[model samples]
Target: MTSRAPAFPLISATGEAMRRLGRWCCVCAALLAAGCATYGPERPGEKIYRDVVFAAPGGHKLRMDIYVPRQSKPAPVVLWFFGGGWSFGSKGYHVNVRDLTTAGIAVASVQYRMSHTAVYPAQLEDCRAAAQWLRDNGARYGIDSTRMGASGESSGGQLAAMLAAAEGKSRIRAVCALYAPTDMVELAQLYSKPGRLSLVDKFLGGPADQKLDVAVNASPLNYISRALPPFLIIHGEFDGVVPLEQSERLFLALTDVGVETQFIVVPGKRHWFRLDNTQFAEVSRFFQVNLKR
Candidate 1:
């Protein structure tokens, strides 16, 4: 998710912007030379040889960083989106996604259309196309078409939930959202801190700009249905940005429709939520269970 004018530099949408992801990948790859940040396979059970590509969304391309475990056979594919409140974030923002590849789950860290240049469904559509592209060619990527999951944090979480909830099993098998937002109306109203910076204006286009109905339709919460894939929501108890309640609504909504779902709230964590050792354990475990081939 990219922000609007005067917003933080989250992600770039063009080949130039995507170059940022490639640059980061090179940096991470080089860091392994000295074993400083051994992204190859330092620890026991890790992904290796992560590569970046740009998924085409017509004129604009969505950046994708694909990771497959070193020496691992055909496995599940996991599409991970970065979080920036639908305003900022890059596929490179989240580092641990590489872990999924090393853990026998092929990971694709994708960059979608952001709120900067466009708005609403544009972002959703770009992400959806990314998933479809992966599913269409899972075999070429050494992925097991039978098992595929999606994961993201914050706004990416909302997008992840939206993708999983909106699509039938034919597209995705499971979803993992980290402190994501579902109801935009409630989120725009609830997290609107009194005077802190807010990207809602740029994301929703403000009262004087576009319209609220636009945000509603693009929101993941509005499209919850039985076609949704299994879900795993992990939220922070004190996420001032996106509350835990949003996760509750999604978890409950999915379960009501017989969709396998799980919800976990981190105790005493805030917006810049860090994955503790335990959280990492849970993260790997969750993906393993849902992304099994």
Candidate 2:
């Protein structure tokens, strides 16, 4: 039998390492538990007014859900739009509604006619009407109309951008768009390569070439001017539905015209990347800075 140096020493070392690792794991678990506890429950005073009609264009009653925060002073409002390719969506779903309201910001999730029911300008008109309604009736709900902003994801993002870019009395003071299409003509060109029309065509009621004027009129990029409000555009680098180039183009246009804009490109994320708590906090901070005046 070949006598080996005492194996006890190595065994003891391994045992000690295992014990240390066990202690480290316990600490980690405790920290995770503590973090989870911080997120305990929704705030008590957050209130949601459901299905309040804001407009009735073409006899189609458009309604919105207003989330009011419990604040001593009136809170700034943000009109939120949900993404559904401009053909399908509802105001019932919203991201960060509780978070926004908890941060002393009121949120209004607006309902608009989808492409299936109406095309192009109808959706924009409905959103404009909603903004107008919020501005006109803001006092009743403790909303500061002058400090209003707009935010949305995907198709909703496009509408939000349009609402901000529009040169009018009801234009939003700040805009945040997540993975929104900026140029309908560019989007149409990209989709035409597959020998099929894109949602742009559906929303515009025809191909870009056939509806050049309408496409130009509907694109947020076309409306970029010095008078436009501050814009925060966020897009995923790996977005397949709406290419990152779309956001880049919009950012370039805004900067070219001396418009205040911030563009964020999230890495390793696709079209539908769900924003985490930290990202939501950043968004809340953006609104707090811009909408809170």
Candidate 3:
């Protein structure tokens, strides 16, 4: 039999392939480690539970970061949703947890399905899930489940209203909606300018005129009733995104139903307001008065 030369070239090729595979594996491992990394800073003196999976809708895990006050007694909790017109936003950013927690209240910064994932009630469903989770398991985290409230800014503000309106089994005792779009149909009209993807359309999956029922159903105004919890609606006078009338319509509708509501207009301010602003104090006070024992 003819002797076969040692397959050194094959061995070298195999060795090179193994090295490349090892490098790729390291890159993937680093990415996964980063994915598991904690985000945002936790306020001092409060215990924070991050990435707590509250619900798994459509097999997708939804999480909330719960911040519990250091108080001995059970503390009231507020379900806060961040805003990016329901298209994009994070539970970590634009949070008022420190302010609320400082007032001896627990804060559950919740994550909801965005318009890109699902529409209308999907976002509301995730929010309601968080509220229900807090209501059920909050005591373990020093939360007084009986005094639960909802608050958010911009699109999240509208969600807070919807959640408070659709109280279901978990009754939200109070709501604070800042610069939220209350009337979707009207908002659709205001944003009818050509060449733009309206946020309302993104939320409802089409133009409000085409999806009238969905628009009406998505609107917090349509769900208002005497049974709703107290609402504090704050809008910026120069809020070019969601018109001032949106908040006014919601306030007026709530008042017509004899529901307790307050509408505050901040002069020269646009959509995003400061956490240190006096209006934010009103937010802290709203929850304090309505939620605190």
Candidate 4:
């Protein structure tokens, strides 16, 4: 017969061909899995972004980390600055820096002037310039510049307050300040009072120095006007650095000018760290309404 007892099988060749096919399939699956893996700490509807050059103040280029939500067509933006007595702090802090992106809101964590180099209005100018950056680059960043807000803590909080109090047409929509120093003159005076509890001296320059005027120029309480934005102030009752009254004073000043402001006092908390779930949730909700579409 023509079949000739069947053809002798090339067992080794067939086996090797099957093995190569299996290996190729496995490699494809692995590549797909890698692509689908975790993008970052970014949560649903959020993304982690960085190093967006927001401005160039004093011939120096400034940068920020922006988190944009997927749900909103044109999301509201929250421009956040970190707290370090105006001498230190990157655009990363409060853990809020990351969470803001996941919540479907756009956030710009900024870097401004520090004490060792620039002070007072220098910081304010940088901040104002950051706002302008947001406004100018809103389309590129997927942000709704018309509904922008600001938030920060301690010296960072003071910067947020200043953003709200700035005299401009593109005013901030809302503000969130945590343990911010409102009255710089008052804080500067307290620096030499037997203790260094109020240490804004290094930030705005010392009271003994010509920094007194500089301090006054930076205080949020100095520029109270009806054109200010709504504010939410969170202060530790025992915050030795900025004092509880600072928030109260700023809240009152905003309210006096028919602007909306809310104050939350964290009992027994220190100048650094210690925000409970309630405080965290409060700020989160505030930003949801104010910073997210």
**TM-score for each predicted model, relative to the true structure:** 0.76, 0.81, 0.83, 0.77
- lDDT tens readout by residue for model 2, 1-293: 01111111111223443343344334324433443233223358777787799998788899988889988899999999877667655676534344689889998988999887889899988988898898899889988888888988888899998888664324577888898989877666655423445566778987778888888888898887887887878887766567677788888788887777777778777665567786777778878887765
Candidate 2 global TM-score: 0.81
Best by lDDT: 3
Encode model 4's per-residue lDDT on 1-293: one tens digit a residue. Answer: 00001112222323443343344334324333443232346667766567777677677777777788776477788888777667655665553444665555688878886776775677888888888888888767678887788888777888988887784325687788888888877655544433332346666655525567787788889988877766778877655455577677777777777776677777677565546767767777777775544
User: Which rank order by lDDT, best down to worst?
Assistant: 3, 2, 4, 1
lDDT of 1: 0.64
Please state the error at residue 281 of candidate 2 in Å.
Answer: 1.9
**Model 1 clashing residue pairs (backbone):** 2-87, 3-87, 46-102, 47-102
**For residues 213-285, could you state the per-residue lDDT of candidate 3 as single tens digits?**
9888888988878889888888777665666777877887888877777778787776666555576788788
Which regions in candidate 2 have their CA more than 4 angstroms from the true location?
1-43, 96-98, 167-171, 193-197
Better of 2 and 4 by lDDT: 2
Residue pairs whose backbone atoms clash in candidate 4:
none
What's the lDDT for residue 271 in model 2?
Answer: 68
TM-score sort, best first: 3, 2, 4, 1
In model 4, what is the error at residue 11, expressed in angstroms?
Answer: 91
